[model samples]
Structures are given as structure tokens and as C-alpha cells.
Target: MTTWTAPAIDRRHEPYRADERTMLEGWLNYHRDTLLLKCAGLTGEQLRTASASPSTLTLLGLVRHMTVVERSWFRQRFAGADLPELYDFDADPDAEFNTVDTADAEADFAAFRAEITAVDAATAGRDLDEVCTVKRRDGTANEISLRWIYLHMIEEYARHNGHADLIREAIDGVTGE
Candidate 1:
């Protein structure tokens, strides 16, 4: 028997009948749920286990990284709120993923969920076409729309969920998010 367990978020895909914003957010939520499902029932140390040798990628790391992404995209980039990162990217560029060993999985997961909840609240009743100017890591300025943020987040979770799939299976022989 396979050892698959239900996660907190439903694994259902987005509904077919929805508007552009609804569809985009739906897909993003689905991918986010997929990533969480990939980590379900694993312990903190198990979460910190590296899937590929010499690569620091872990379920906990992914959760932490996405927490950073959600805060950056919704609070800072989309809503134009000037907020410092939860993790110091300048001092430790890869702190989110690299600091997994020291992280408490339960607290990190709660923080990730909180960020998602905050993002949803921030973007609610907002127009998708609203543009926000962002300064990139290389100091190049670019304007991006709220719609692009949704799409980008969807892609981000989807790509990372793929790695989560591999990592989870490596951990427990569990698969199918």
C-alpha cells in the first residue's frame, strides 16, 4: 500500500469556469497546495534532508523560500509597501534555502501560510492591470503588472513543486501530489 496522506490544502485543481484573475489565483493556490502536499507528514529533520547530493534543496527550504517570495511579491512589489525581507538576502543571499537545518519546520510552515493569507488580503479587490515599478537585483528598474505577479508566482510554485516531488519521493518513497 502506498503511504499517501492528505495535506492541509485540498489537492483539487482550479475550476475551469472562472475569470482571468480567478483562474490565475486558482492555479497559483493549486501549485502552492501541491508543494505543501509534497511535504506532508515529514518530520523537521526529514524536511531538512537533501534530495540530491550536495544540493541544499529540502522541503523546509522550499517552504521558507516561498514565504520570502510571497512577501516580496504581494507586500513589497505589488502593493508598494516598503518592508524588509523576513530573511536577510543581502547578508545571506540563499538564507531561505540554506538555513533549513536551523529552522523549526512547524513555525516556518505557519509563517509561509501567514504570508499567503496576507498576500490574498493585500491583493483582494485589486485590479490585475495595476502596474508596479520594481528595482531588480542588478539595479535595473522595470514595471510589472499585478497580473504578471500572479502568473509568475504560479510558475514559481509549479517549478519548485516539481523538485518537491523528487525530494519527497526520495524521502519516503511517497509520490503524486
Candidate 2:
């Protein structure tokens, strides 16, 4: 087992000082960067390797899934654009895990990077008080503030980064601050 340090967020350069929105965005950025760092220098096979029965998730799949999620939540839902889905939900929500082949490594990384770049652009110039609507899993629509979206994205990245930490550690016994 390996111990994981929480991702660091530099507050000094934040746009909003010590406000909740700035803190959340900073944390989200930190975790997103940390995830990319963890995947660095890993072979495609290592990135795609799945552990035993208890956990079928892989770092590669998580990367793919997170890319999709960021696009779906921020780019599509919040932005109110009808963007095409990244992965076919009708096939399997776990498609990222099952569909990854060694040959797809470069493509996957490219897509992930592109998604993040787009997300950054979409978020730029947006105020924390902006409102957005999203369809819930149960078919009900709820309006959300940009502040909530930032906070939720931060939490999502933080939780998944913990999983990435474990998976990367298991892959090579690598540990970091």
C-alpha cells in the first residue's frame, strides 16, 4: 500500500482571492494536473492494466472517462450545447475500461488533452454567479450555479485522483508527495 498526498492548490495567483469559487477551481486544476502527472512515463500496457476481481478500473480508462465527464458536465450541460457524447452510453458506461486497447493509447491521450483544453477555454471569462441547467439521471432538470459546478468538479477530480494514486502505485510501487 502507498500513501497519497492531497494535490496542492496555489492560492496566491487565484483570480478571486480566498473566495470559495477560486479555491474550488484551484483544487480542480491541481487534481487534473496531478492526474496527468501520474500518467506520465507509463506504458500503454501499464496504463491499461486492470487489477484483480475487486477493482476493474484502470488509469487509462479513468483518463478517458474523466475527459468525457468534463465535457458532458461543463462543455455540454453547463454551456447549453448539444455536443455529441464522447463514448456511447448505450453500449456500456464502463466502455472506457473494456474498450481500451494498446493501440488506442495515443488517441486516448490526445482526446483527453483536447477535452481539457476545451474545458479551460469554456470556463475562461465566466463569472462564479453564472447559472446553468443540467438534466439529472432521473430525468429532472436542475439549475446550478457556476460555483457549485466548480466545487463539484473539484470533488470529482479529487476523489478520482485518489484512485489514480492507488492504481499507479500498484503498477510500479511509485510514491510521491
Candidate 3:
């Protein structure tokens, strides 16, 4: 059987000057593409290769994680979509990361792309300042804005992409900014 490889990604350059919304979305997209670029052309086994001993982080795991993050923030928390967890975190807190050994890399990639589409649709036409109130486990309600979600997503992707850079480098010695 042939090994499945992730497709190539053409990341756009974020503009130096733009409106607030444009700047945030542009940087988010750039970082999103950066993560995929780090995994491009690698087979499923290669994508599942752990960074180092004791850390199960992998390119494929990051992809799964961000997919969950995208759905959790944009759909469940902000957009108020009633949805079940993508991966069974109850059964295993690190399900996404730990299940890579038998995961279908191609399907996971497709799901990630699909979640991004759904998140975009969910947030479309919503004002950046539009707020959503989430009930915490502690019985307190916290209000969050769409703008804050965007900023947080950018930070999440940026941190994971750094891990991806190292994992990709360890896999094949390919490195870049």
C-alpha cells in the first residue's frame, strides 16, 4: 500500500498595513498555512513521528488539535453550536495526540479543513465585538468577544507551529521560518 502524504500549502504573506480585522485574519491564515507547510509531502508515518522521547507531539497531532480548537472556540463557545466533542476527550484526555499510531492522517486533514470552513461560516457576518457568555465549570459565566477568539487562535497556532518546526526538522532535517 502507498503511504498517504499531506498536500502542499501556499501560505500568503500577511500585509504590513491593513484594517484590524484584516490584519488579524491575515496573520491567522498565515500561521494556519505555516502549520500545514511544515507537514507537506510527509507520509502518515512520518507525520506521526514524535518530536523526542517523552513528548508525543507530532505534525499530525497538531493538525488534529487545531481542528478541535477551531471547532471548540468558533462553533461551540462563540457561535453556540450544540455539538459533541470531535475526539473523545473523556475516554482519553489526549486522544488526538495519543491515537496517531492508528489514525487516518488523510481523513484527519480533511476534517480539519472542513472544520475551518464551518467555523468561517459560523462567524461570518458577526461583529468582532459581539460577545458570547460561556458558563464555566465553577458556576461563573465569562463573556468573550469574537475579536479575542481570533487573537487567541492566532496565539494557539503560533505556539503549535513552533513545535511543528522542530518535529519536521527532526523527521527530515528540513527547516525554515
- TM-score on alpha carbons, each prediction: 0.92, 0.84, 0.96
Local lDDT at 17 for model 3: 100
Worst-scoring 10-residue span by lDDT in model 2:
1-10
Q: Write the per-residue lDDT of candidate 2 for residues 1-177, one digit (tens) a residue.
A: 112222333322234566665577677777777777777777777878775556778888888888888897788878776788867678887777777754366677788879988988888878877888777889999889878888788788778888888888998888663
Q: Report, for every candidate in turn, its global Cα lDDT versus the true structure.
A: 0.86, 0.76, 0.92
Model 1: per-residue Cα lDDT over 1-177, one tens digit each:
222332456576887999998899889888888888888787778888898988999988999999999999888888988887888778899999888767778788889989899899999999999989999989999999999899999989989999999999999999885
Candidate 3 residue-wise lDDT, 25-142, digit = tens: 8898898899999999999999999999899999999999999999999999999999989788999999999999889999999999999889889988899999999788899999
**How many backbone overlaps does candidate 3 show?**
0
Model 1 lDDT vs. the true structure? 0.86
CA lDDT, candidate 3, residue 79? 94
The C-alpha stretches of model 2 lying farther than 4 A from their native spots are: 1-22
Q: What is the alpha-carbon RMSD of candidate 2 to the true structure?
A: 5.6
- Which candidate would rank higher by lDDT, 2 or 3? 3
Better of 1 and 2 by TM-score: 1
- Give the CA lDDT, 0 to 100, for residue 37 in model 1: 86
Which lDDT value does model 3 have at 175? Answer: 98
What TM-score should be assigned to candidate 2? 0.84
